[model samples]
Target: MSAPLLIFADTILTGFDPDGTPILLEQAALLIRDGRIADAGTADTMRRRHPEVEAMGGRGKAVIPGLINAHHHVGVTPFQMGAQDHPLELWFAERLRMRDVPPDLDTLYSAFEMVASGVTTVQHLHSRAPGDVTAVLDRANRIIGAYDRLGMRVSYSFAMRDQNRVLYDDDQVFLELLPAAMRPVAARYLAGFGLSLDEQAQVFYELRNQHSGKERIAIQIAPANLHWLSNAGLEMAARLHDATGAPMHMHLLETPYQREYAARRGQGSAVEQIQRFGLLGPDLTIGHGVWLSRDDLALCKENGVCICHNCSSNLRLKSGTADLNAFLATGLPIALGIDEAGINDDRDMLQEMRMALTLHRPSGHHSPAPTAAQVLQMATRHGAATTPFRERIGGLAKGQAADLVVLDWDRVTYPWQDSRNGFADVLVRRAKAEAVAQVMVAGRTVYADGTFVNVDRKAELDRLKKWQSRPRTALDEEMAELADAAIDVVHDYYKNWR
Candidate 1:
């Protein structure tokens, strides 16, 4: 057993109380024993209680619970890969052209970005991979292994979407509309990848059985999005959740087109359809509720369904802003997600927090806007609730995992403003990834002084770059062209919808 660690910082944010109030402490010290917080109190009091423990941090640092990213994809930044700023529907087709990289390389690439930005826990909504059952499970395991080795607490969900791979509706008509030469190419592109729904659920159970015992990883069900999934797919997801008690993450009404699809299908709202399938509950997390109506938000709150607000992704994809002020008014549990599409094109949670705080200020005086402290809680505790980690990893309390980030106060607050200013406010306004001096998970320092403790990030990135530089195959070029040819048909399909 290792000696207890006494981590002292200038300020500490204990996430939130049971009643949803922020717990702020000044000159706080936290004691870590056996990877869990044994005690947390004033630095002087803790120091007096545990005189022999090794100490970390000092006067110019502030410690807060590590940020939780509620929605994320492994390694494919759409804009970076030619899937530019189209609406979510069109962007899906463009993403078909993205070149595939090794799962491990892809996982590590984004994991590095996330950790550097002080995110310790992530909901890694796994993207579809091209493979048979064995190959797909192998890739999922590889992604999990990468996160495990990197010391990140992750909820790994194999994203399941069984329909509408190309357009909003059935793509047969879209395929017929395509040029003859591009038909086969379009068919190949539209032919979805990965295992069937049954096989995916089976693999999910297998993965849960194998890795649920690990301290840093959990498995969950992810129905990719409303339009992408069939009624049968949604039912399978609900059944899996019921049988396994695993949490679910799904993209809700992310765009105006999705709203139109739900209305056209006579579903009233996508939220209503999810409720009809018996999937609404505390164990479900809806991502990007940008187009959710007032009633939809109420329904989400009533069902205890958490909403992960992906502020940057919503804007980047041209999805309109979610009425966050209304969400707050409804007392809905909200969390933060970068969706791997941040405003700055990097997975920076600090920036995400700042954006969420600033983006929803337009609700005027009647609606209560989110404060910096509340946004921090959304990034930490609320986000943790969306994943399997839940109570174990979100906050700094006795018996909770000691996952936290220590920011250099001098670096973040260089101008040396008045100490009376609220620390959370200052942090949200000024903190950046560069200010993260140390990051710890499970009482161990995984990142400190600009280097990852368990992996050689630079070497891994170099290898990934080399792999990406390799020549593209004929099929890759053909698919890229097919995506271009099919974009117009996809657009017209939605345009012509009655």
Candidate 2:
């Protein structure tokens, strides 16, 4: 354990007020002890009370709760792997050509990006890879271990899906649509990920057990999406959540095609189907709820389910914009995520927050746009609700965990003159990764002065470069051709949907 320390900031944004306003303080201090906040008050009072404690961030610093990324898939993006953006349905086909990176290196790469942008916690929804139970467990260990070594809090879930691995139909049915010669090759490739529903559940159980009782790690359930999971798979996901009391993060109705698929499945809306399986509740978080109808929104609100808005992902993949105005009006808990990558292809939460702030303003003069307080709440407090670390790491309070960011206020407000705008407003509108002077998780400094405390960023990046420089094997060449062939078929499959 580290010794007691006080972080004194020229400005402190603790959280939101009851009226949805920001709670700001000037010249305040937070006293941290044993990895938790022990006290908070004016800087003068804290200094008088805890005079012996070591101090940091005396002036030109603004402190706020560490940001959270509620939905994420991988470190390097599909675009970086030579896959271009298409609609979510066709985008899956493009991902087939993505070069495989080792789990540890991939996780660490994103951790570096996230920590630099003041994101101290991430809900890592691990995508299904081509592997059996043993191989899957090994990958999960490497991912969780990477976060452990980086000193970042992670709520890890292996996304479970039993069918529709390639497109929005039965695997055998979709494979038959391919050319005769390619069918067997694609079939062989798909067979590599042949984990039964029972085995998938076993993987989740093993991971949860293995990572239990860790401070900065959490294991949760993720049912991949509406089209990916069969009815049995959905029930299994709910059962896993019920048995372990772990929260679930599921992708649902992310696009119009997905909504149509749910309708055509004869199971009612995706929200209703999940509700039938007892999966709609406070423990559930819906990722990219871009196409939820009025009734769907009502159901989510009634059940206390949260929504994670992936603003950049929605725009990049041609997924329609989610009605953020409606979500706010309905009073549903909202969180922010950079799904595969941000608009700039990096995990910058400040930029994600900025996108969420500006993307919802309609044309009407009096239309309700999101306040900076609301967006900040989404990135911090509401984001906490979507993870296992809820209420433990969001806000800086007397007993909350000391997870926070210290911004160089000078960088945030350089050559500026306005003071009437609220602190949250000014900060969210102007802050960038460059303004993040330090980041702390559990009262430990992980990033400071643009340098990582635990890992060598340039060294790891060079290693990734070396890995990417290796020559492609025959299997990789085959997969690339297979992926290219599947794209048109995947595109044609979705054209007839009403």
Candidate 3:
């Protein structure tokens, strides 16, 4: 057993209240024992109460709940590769052409980036694996094992998309529009991937039964997106969610084209369609509601559904900005996610928080614009609610998991050191990955002093580099050309949509 730890910080931000008020405490200290927070209070009080505990952190540092990434993907950052700014539909095609690496390396690469940015938990929505049922399940296990080795808390979900792999609607029309030479290639690409809804559900149940009690790992369901699934597939999602009470995460109306598609297909909106499917509830979290209307927001609010705003990914994919102000007005819970498409092309939650704070400010002064405190909550507490880790993490309360980020206040609060300047505001506004001095999860130090403690990140990265240098297959070359040929057709499909 590890010795009890008393962490002292110049200040602590205990996240935000439901009304968006900051809970700032000064001269605070946290008492950790048996991987949980034993107590949190003023440093003097904690020191008096627990005189025997060893201490960490001191003056010139601030501590907060570890950031929660409510939405992300495993082993994929499209913008960093050749897939640059394009609409979500076109970007999907471009991403198909990117090189592939081992799933374990891909998972670890992103996990390191997230931890360096003070994120301790991530909701990893795993994309479809290229294999039969057993192979896909094995790949999921590999991703989970990578996280386990890194000591990062992750909610893993097998992304379920049973239809509409290419365009918002029938992909056959788009395939036909491709050159005759590429027609066969496109068909094979679509057919070769993806599992039936039944197969996906079976895998989910099997994995959940096998790994349910594992430490720091939670299995959930992801329907991919509104247009990606058939009605039967969505029903399966609802059933699995009901059976396991596992949280559900899905992309909804991420682009204007998706909004149009939803309206046409459902005779109303995507939110309404989801409501009809019995999938709207506290357990359901919409990944990116960038194009949700006021009525849709109202429905989400009524159903207790949450939204994870991927501010950077929306901008990178040219998806319209989500009106976070509107979501907040409806009293809906909002969380933050990098979605593997951060503006810096890295999974930096601090940078994402800064962007989210500035992106939603109205031109004129408003009564309730997004505050720095609210953004901090979105990155920390609100995000935890989106996963099963909600009760255990998201705060430094008694009996909660000892997950937190310690920042070098001297590095962040330089040039101005007034206590009245609001530590939460300063940290959110100016802090970067460099300010993250240490990250702890479950009373264990996972990262400290500019290196990971649990695993050799350098060696893992070297393995990835070697894998990337390997020769590309014939399918890789064909997919690159096929993606280029299909981009124009995808653009035209949305352009002419009624």
Candidate maximizing lDDT: 2
Candidate 3 ranges beyond 4 A from true positions = none
lDDT of 2 by residue, 1-498 (tens): 999999999998887776777777799999999999999999999999999999989798999999999998899888988899988888888888887898888989988999999999999999866788989999889998999898999999999999999888899977998878779879997898889989999999999889888889999999999789988999899889889999999999999988998998976898998899999999999999999999999999899999999999999999999999888887877999999999999999999999999998888989889998899999999999999999997898789999999999988999883989878888879999999999999999999999999999999899998998899988788888888889988978878885
Candidate order, lDDT descending: 2, 3, 1
Question: Highest TM-score among the candidates is held by which one?
Answer: 2
- Candidate 1 lDDT by residue in tens digits, 313-356: 99988889898877766666789999966998889899999999
Tell me the spans in candidate 1 whose CA falls farther than 4 Å from its real position. 18-20, 192-194, 363-367
- C-alpha TM-score for every candidate: 0.97, 0.99, 0.97
Q: How accurate locally is residue 316 in candidate 3, as Cα lDDT from 0 to 100? A: 84
lDDT of each: 0.86, 0.91, 0.86
* Residue runs of model 2 more than 4 Å from their true location after superposition: none
Q: Model 3: per-residue lDDT, tens digit, 130-183?
A: 777898899999999998899999999999988878888777777877889999
Q: How many backbone clashes does candidate 2 have?
A: 0
lDDT of 1 at 470: 88
The local lDDT score (0 to 100) that residue 397 gets in candidate 1 is 78
